[model samples]
Target: MSNNSNTLLGVLAGTAVGATLGILFAPDKGINTRRKLVDEAVATKESLADSALDLRNTVAATVATNKETLDTKIENLVSDASYKADDVINQLEGKLKELKAKNKKLQKS
Candidate 1:
């Protein structure tokens, strides 16, 4: 299976094993055991939330880095295109001037 599927299955299996172990090992009365389980669940929820936030931050950083790299590439392409355009315009202007001068000489002859 895919990596994501494997990771999800692993998490589910780990959670089930952990919950079973916690319930089996408790020495308190039923009510206290239930309360303890609730507390553990809450703590696990918080830990998962923290992990989700960390993942979000990492994704944001990666996106920012990719955007900067794309912007740099676009800027370089624009600069190169502008330089090429200028060279073409200069060459065309020089050719036009030469043509005009040749025409004038031909007319005079």
Candidate 2:
């Protein structure tokens, strides 16, 4: 989750707690207070849902970016290894030619 998500959740939690406490202490009629509590609960639920969506988006974006970077790195490593293998094959071929030439010269002498 992102920093903004964390902050938003923290703020929402604080607001919900504060509102509940204030309503409990107030000297309002019981029916009105109950209605206000229901309204506050609905609003808090919506806010939490929105925050969860934001968090999910952030995680998905992060995973996509990391996967791309890892793929690029793996491709580069394979390319480098292929070049090195070709160089080794070339060196071995050169050595084999030298040995064959030396053998022919010795046979003629």
Candidate topping TM-score: 2
Clashing pairs in 2: none
Q: Show where candidate 1 strays beyond 4 Å.
A: 1-13, 20-28
TM-score of 2: 0.86
Candidate 1, residues 23-87, lDDT tens digits: the string is 86968798887787787778777766765666678778989999999999999999999999999
Model 1, total clashes:
0
Give lDDT for model 1: 0.80
lDDT of 2 by residue, 12-86 (tens): 999999999999899999999999999999999998998898788888999999999999999999999999999
Go through the candidates in order and give the clash count of each.
0, 0
RMSD of each: 3.6, 1.8
Instruction: List TM-scores for all candidates, in order.
Output: 0.76, 0.86
Q: Using lDDT as the measure, which candidate wins?
A: 2
Error of 1 at 61 (Å): 0.5
